[model samples]
Target: MAWDDKRVETWVGIMLRTGVMIAAAIVLIGGVLYLSGRGPSPRNNYRHFQGEPAQYTSLSGVVHNVNLHEPRSLIMLGLLILIATPVARVGMCIAGFLLERDRMYVVVSTAVLVILLYSLFFHK
Candidate 1:
């Protein structure tokens, strides 16, 4: 379609509508990983730096713990990050739609926002 066409803004609507849906999927999967005890350090997180590479930090203090090296868990974590990638795209889409002065995208963003909020609240 022509770039100058007014309906071009619909592309923005489509992007915003799709992005948050993907984010919802990501957090859901992340919740599953958390439930399954997938993190490398349950009580703390691993920190790599100049001083101590094996040190982990959490609510407690510095400790030593092996990270989760399980392939399945790693894959799940990757999937979770993948699921979260579209959030910025949604904002970009909203900006594009607003720049084009499109009202359709406003409605789309509203619906997407509701779904996004619902997914956040009800996610596993």
Candidate 2:
């Protein structure tokens, strides 16, 4: 099957929207965690440029069991918003390919998505 350009664009839009929502959600969750006394936000359970989070750099990235409150909630929110921008751009491309009814693109996206999901759960 092949989708026209308009339909492909729609799919791309959907993916972009999804990315935006995900970014917003991550920010919201991070804010809640930080305001609750956790510390700096984390990319995830793991830290970048470093193997482990030194046990003190969990989601909060603060002292163990210590929860103070977000000193810069707005900043964290901004960072998340920035993160989503590029994500949305790329997501749109992928989504568009799928929506275009390109079987090749669809299969590739599915494989990539599956791999990503698996890594998220079991790559540790």
lDDT of each: 0.50, 0.56
Residue 91's C-alpha lDDT in candidate 2? Answer: 52
Pairs that collide in candidate 1 are: 40-68
lDDT at 13, model 2: 71
**Which pairs of residues have clashing backbones in candidate 2?**
37-67, 37-68
> Which lDDT tens digits does candidate 1 get at residues 7-108?
544665566566556645644654565657644555544574454322322211121222253333333434444444454455555666666677798579
* Tens digit of per-residue lDDT, candidate 2, span 1-124: 6667676666667766776776577566667665565545654554446653343323233323332344344334445455546544545556667666677876776677666546534676
- Candidate No. with top lDDT: 2
Global CA lDDT of candidate 2, please?
0.56
The TM-score measured for candidate 2 stands at 0.37
lDDT accuracy of residue 112 in candidate 2: 70
Query: Which regions of candidate 1 are displaced past 4 Å?
Result: 1-68, 86-88
